[model samples]
Target: MLVKAFDKNIRQNKTTTINTNFVVIGGGTAGVCAAITAARQGTKTVLIQDRPVLGGNASSEVRLWILGATSHMGNNNRWSREGGVMDEILVENLYRNKEGNAVIFDTVLLEKVLEEENITLLLNTSVYDVKKSSDTKIESVQAFNSQNSTEYVIKSPIFCDASGDGIVAFKAGASFRMGAETKEEFGEQFAPDKSYGELLGHSMYFYSKNTNKPVKYVAPKYALKDITAIPRYKAIGKGDKGCRFWWFEYGGRHDTIHETEEIKYELWKVIYGVWDYIKNSGEFEDVDNMTLEWVGTVPGKRESRRFEGLYMMTQQDIIEQRQFDDAIAFGGWAIDLHPADGVYSELSGCTQWHSKGIYDIPYRSFVSKDIDNLFLAGRIISATHVAFGSTRVMATTGFCAQAVGMAASICVDKNLKPADLLEKGEIKNLQNELNKLGQSIPNVPINKSSNLINEATINASSILNLNQIPYNGDWFSLSISAAQMLPFKANQNYKFKVLVKAEETTTLQVDLRTSIKSKNYAPEVILETQNFNLEKGEQYIEISFSNPVPNNQYGFVTFLSNKHASLKTSNNRYTGVLSVFNGVNKAVSNNGKQTPPDNIGVDTFEFWTPHRRPDGQNIAMDISPAIEAFNADNIGNGFVRPYGTTNAWVANLNDKNPSLKIEWDSEKELSEIKLFLDPDYDHPLESTLMGHPEEVAPFCVRNYTITDLQGTILAKKEGNYQTINTWKFDSKIKTKGIIIEAEHPSVNVPASIFEIICS
Candidate 1:
């Protein structure tokens, strides 16, 4: 039954005025981080999201998995986790919603924004009008709340355009560019020879489920006829679901923003057509119960209008691994470029080019050169199209948002513009503050002068006594020999050990080399060489140097062309260690047959190791009094990558109850303690995929207790999920020494601590 009510009432339109210190437009991943950072920093912030839900493409409407430095676990990115806010979001999602439910993930984003006291969140609001103080700066923005039909004029001293389309920057008449730049313009080798106005198109994804009973899908009148026209139709499998149809894209040659409606309609047809083919094609087996559960209405857009900033990132900067002094963020995803034709193109889905390692992103790329008060984040940040391919991922964009938000807060405090902050040499101040806030800036350490841990006498339960984790099992020699490198601090005594497995009696030759240049991974200078005759089975050989290692040097151990013997390797690779397979690429096929070169260089494997310990501990090149973990240098040594074992402090296995003790020369008042734990970077944080069994890594301290020297309990927490844990006292307490008892959930690994700070 339908009920109707008749009322004689007159309603008047309302206009509201809101003032804030910072206004962030768009509630996407970047905007969410930007708003939260600003509001948490005590700035009055207003976040205007066009859609009812946040997350933009990552929202339930268009389900694109958030990927960044990890690159969906591709390209040997073992320890590449985006730090700061992105890290928090990923860890929380993994802990709370490990099943990868999209509906639940939406609430995770919503709860975070609502928890910020200083942020005024306006959902279902679209900003269309911009009021500029002059041609050079923006004064305010006018937004319309479609749900309530209310007009809001939001005024702010600073504005960040994370709208993905750069709507505010465009409306403000800021200088920007659309489409690709010519190869000659930026000397980008990856760019097309001829420039085109076409951009990367839009895509729609759908989820399908299996029902107990048979279900049918009816093709709509507008459904695509003759699925044979799509060459990739054969690639779709029966079990595939949402986000798998990333290639189902269209509308690149057309205007993506203005012509979004037409694009959505075309995407709808393609989606239905693909589903019809999958269900009725008769090629799939045992899929009679499969039905389309959900299909996206909105298209996930890829490239659009990009704002021009003080510095434009180019492909060369990414490939060459350029280290910028003003680096505020980092990206390691491959340069993945899709054709302008998108799904219609006959070629493969995309072309990808990889760098040796991660690259740095500068702050200059996020601040506008033409618009003084405007900041750019997300996909719209200043970058050539070739470079944008790598920087466009959600996690990378989130980091950009974090940097912009921090910069905005600084601007509000200093009464300076975005460009003024950079010109006045305040970028270092921004970097220092970011480190303090747990943001990871490559190669930069947190400012140590103010850290109380620096003054304290640091000690731990036990220090690692082995060079590498022990390898007791039999390890056969590969067809080719290999080499491994270990990194150490300057002026340190070091001993190299290797476990040899000889099939028969054989002589093994080894060479030790040093890094030729600073900051380079490859070794060039040979330090020592030795040859030894080994018996069958396993033998432990140790080599000690008479002189202490020089400053900033890497010890490279190479097994020279040993065909009769293979060195025993540990199960996992440790930080500061690199294994090279005979210094040459191997050609092999699935059937274990030598194949022709595929042009891809397979240099090293992540879990392969050449050094071993007799104690069978999973140790990697560890050098420690264990006190370095409490040092301020651990805060941002840029060694967050999991396999890189340099920065973290590991407890010795001898202690039954591992504890870290800090003893001060004099009594000090302590109010708070900050602890950073290892969250298992090897695990990918994605809702669309099945996560690890444990919400928090077993290696992470599941239960921990903090106490004073007199045995008074300070604080205790159990089942912690976050990487960064902070315990604040009700009141400051005077203590000469403190003790931390951390219990590992698993017996296989010891408790690891990344950074510890006392305030």
Candidate 2:
């Protein structure tokens, strides 16, 4: 090829236009979820991202751990991990990358997007302009990919704005708020003031590794010269890396969007300065062999330009745990806020205020108030600043974005706007659709319309009868108070017996506790207390309680802490039983109890959380008149997760072959069968840094087979490790009855199923 002389007129880059049913801007967690969900729901979708990678803050570039409800098991929100597509991705990541490598996580997100045939993903593409069909509707958007030197104009009927900076919404003239709102605006007593901070800031992280040999480093000219300028400089240690220094931040005082570059420079200076002190300051040892392995180029952004929607979620809604008729999603993270000065400020890095329990998110919060075709997601959803502090986490953002995705699909099918779904009879349809997709909405049961199982009689080979947890020779000291959470029926008198040992003669106190609300897990109401005098040697002691059980719910059989006593624990873990301790998880709670300032619109309570796997063994105990919650009838209850009671059908532990049989009055054609299994929702599937202990949920059924009344095998599944498993037959089968034979994943745990549906 020969080069010619440059002409006066310039040549334009290649341009392309694509038309689709839906468009999601910003390929962060929210955008990834929205685009994937819409595509799965039979909609043609396009996902656009300005960066080369997907996950916004959770990507390898930023490397912040993704979390939502079940916040590090720090609070009382048990079995609260998000469900549906977000759950699928988290579970899959845990199965593949339990080590939590950030680069490996990037591949997981890419694979999920690529697997969806209906989705089109564009990376390193930035949307610079927006085109509107009318004053109130966006028609298309203009974007350019720097890597390819290409311009793209994408047109869609519905659009979702999940960009961290609200780029598309801002260009489309959507109303938004940048800083914290005044207390009077939303009656938010916990709202931050001018001195406290108006917005949460940006943060960058660096990872360090040991070379095992001597290494040297020299600071560049731009590196910070003074480490003493940072008030918390002494808090930095030699071995600290990544989010261990999440407080190492800046850029809250300036414009977070336009001044991002300036903010990034400040963060880099702080990081390099911190590293320089760790290396050559001679204040620490063992760091001579350590070097910086990776540094974040893009800072993880917390908040900016929250766009307005139909309804603005406020602090009162979260604190009160208010129920909404249009509820579509849920959130449980604490209301966490940081200082404007970031790491340089003398104040603590964050202030987290947790509610008593999880709260519902309404569908209105995802819909635009002015723009007819616009949908808002992620940190841009409508909410007051105080409420945004809790809802801004990645998992919460991703779950709410799922609602937006499904709403977009419905809008395309019915030719209706987002507001149309909020009408009296239409909201339930949306909820029903979400339930069908495996989303566990708080207080929302699965809708059963055309399900064939609803008209059949269900029977199991053996239902779990609560009796005893055999001792495994493992003993735990009673240095802290421990409680066993078990399902108790209404108007029942229960007796519990446990093996106890005392170094000296001690008086052990046992109390029966329950939550004031039936659905909540917090044990605030003490029903009864009993004191038993124990001898110096190990012996079995029994306690009886006849307190009034208001309704069927999980009650806490608590054994108060005794310094001179110890109790036996069992390795026989059940599907719905858990043991908790009144202890502190310094990440979320400073002390074992939460005591807030008076009238701050937050609650004060004790945190009773379970220990992680290989440690959280069940209390060995025997009960008379065992719990009857796990029956075959529970399979048709329409609930797939534990609420006030265990909504699962668990077989007896000793049953070698557990099976379920469903019989109808007459033969009916069935095309598909779906089974919802147990996934141990108590485990918080953090994307990175916090690695999980198990690849597959220990309570899941590994193998199962379905057969008709004539004993002909219809479908079989092996090595199953997911929450939902579906069997679609090539042709409709006419059968009067069907039987499901399943095997437990482990001998310690029994086979359990939450729901079964056939159509």
Candidate 3:
């Protein structure tokens, strides 16, 4: 790949030619995201793009929406972090475009990457040739421009192919495939059962505007022909509508990336004639003066060279929802098929398949099936004709780019090749890091509604901090708005404390009602009633144990269908997956599959155990003080008194005494903390902190650990702890307070401590 050399006078600060850790080609949706990721990982990264601007189809040329994995199927649904940099784009769009839609989203995309200090983007450059010695690893890439050419001879420990086409992989001798393969190959339903000689053609998209005027009309000769002659084709828009996005057709199949100009030229002439035919016909009398808005010279190429990867995804993967240990990104687009001859037929030609939810894009599909260093992204990633139909969308491609970058970074950091990451011992870190950056390896639809706090319109999938801020839990109003509900049968209830102010408050009332319902499963309108509100102040309140229904059940427990009231096996929408967001657990799955108890509180949107009973004393939950210290206690320490010695709860650190002490050591610095119980949750006395048969334990546990006021430990005893022991902190320092949450023997406890510490 070639990038225009910097001007001779150009000198970036801290002039250091750091060894190139990663080399990413093709600055499209996937490429840019990959570059951003590698740079973010502190790697010396370079972004190579053949185009002048960033963004692939969503650029100034094609102009499409940057969809992320945030749009929910329900009314009160929330978004997730499935959108990495795209989230930043949406937030920027919300912040800048109060009206919401920005005409030139590409400029915004360019600005985002340019502002990042770690990334260096090279536009108006193309990859001409790559150099190699042993024929396995790339030594350096040589890029060129018309006027002058320069070779970036620096060693690239890792290489990523983010080009919309598998150009880099092709150059690096990576295996690849293209066109419709035999149905038996991937066992795709729509596949022709035999490999085809042709594949779908590319498109040059354009937009139009309707002025609602009157113009002399006349029907063209061909417009008079039978519309049903084409396969699955229709001539419905006899009038005017700005519906021209899919009104594209290709001329012939050749070099898509190179022949885009010629294809767009052919599409242009057809556009004028098609418009003339419409205006001349009496059918579109309502839209007389329909004018064209924008046209693209560079067409969005759908079908192109596909590089062979370790895992060539087939239609069966989508239908079966195959789960791989190295899953990375997800795709939700429908399987849209166009002819390779660039013709629109009504019968057996055009086909589409809507994905039930987000399907995982396996990690193997990203790297070459045979080549050592080559990795493919975008439309080039391995997918059967049918599977690619859905996986080739823009939002999905952007995430694929992020995965490519992450894998590249992993190779450089761990000193491994592309195949090694997948075939070698373990690449869990790469998978984990990619996931941390809004990528999914689950290959499942994401439902994060249960985990979000704020009602976001565009920004979806955000992490909810379990950390609570002091509040007077009065009025007791906590709501979860869902676009729809799911049918579930969880016998569990959430345990949380609400701090309420008692005086001047009376008449506690709570109401439950459905906001939306499905078409067939609407609630019976036998009686009419309204919901009631409670007083503004109450001392303490819980998710009512005595009340038959909790307010959250009305919304929290939504049916699969839009119907406000639907039952399981009612032909209702109980099969759609719903993701609830909670900081502790990133994802939970429920298809509204079963009917839950009428008395159960769906308010918490949680699953309960039958033995413990709903709202049971032993139930672990998120609780906070309802009232401020109006009349305080001078006690240095506070503890929750359990009913019996058999009902003990370990001290998960919340606030620590200045007099406590602790210590610990490990091979690597520990950033996160979690406890484990041994005997059983109900019996804390029999618990032990011993590593299982697994190769190694996660953290070093001490019999006692102490932290100063600043939250840093001063000392600790290395030993297995199993009791109601105060996992002490290093008390020698000073800061605020700390909490020592016991791990095992009790799995229900949630203890997370940060900040409050001593230097």
Residue pairs clashing, model 2: none
Q: CA lDDT, every prediction?
A: 0.74, 0.89, 0.45
- Identify the superior model by lDDT, candidate 2 or candidate 3: 2
Models sorted by TM-score, best on top = 2, 1, 3
1-759: candidate 3 lDDT, tens digit per residue: 888776888653331232578877877777777788778777778777777778776676655544433221211222222345543454344334433222445666788778767777777767767767567767766664432344344357777777776666777777666667764565554674223324666665555566666444343443324333333234536432221334456643556667767676666655555555556544555566666556566676777777778878876576445567778765654455665555443333344443333456788888777667777777888877677776776666777777777777778778888778867854566665654444434532222221111111111011112222224111211222111122211232322333433233333322212222211111211112222223444343443222222221222321111112211111110001122211121111222221233421112122211111111111111222211111111011111111011111222223232121222221112232222211111110100111122211111122444433355654444444321222333333232333332222112222211111111
All predictions: root-mean-square deviation over Cα?
5.6, 1.5, 16.3
Which model, 1 or 2, shows the larger TM-score? 2
**Cα TM-score of candidate 1:** 0.84
Which prediction has the highest TM-score against the true structure? 2
Off by over 4 Å in 1: 1-12, 76-78, 193-198, 472-645
Which candidate should be chosen as best, given lDDT against the real structure? Answer: 2
> Could you tell me the C-alpha RMSD of candidate 1 in Å?
5.6
Model 1: per-residue Cα lDDT over 1-759, one tens digit each: 997577588654589999899999999899999998888788999999999899998888788878787654444343567877778888888888877777777888999999999999999999998999998899999999978989999999999999989999999988888888876788775675333224788999889899999998788989887887787878888888788678888877888889989999998998898889888888888788999999999899998898899999999888777899999988877777777777777866666665545788999999888888999999999999889989998988987789899999999999999998778999998987776666767777766764677778777776544444546434647455556655555666566666777888888877666544444333445667778888987787776654444654445566766677876765443323345443221111111112222432212222112221221123222233211222323433434333333466666555578788888899999988888787765455765443446577555777889899999999898988788888888999899988988875455456667777788
What local lDDT score does residue 335 receive in model 3, on the 0 to 100 scale?
57
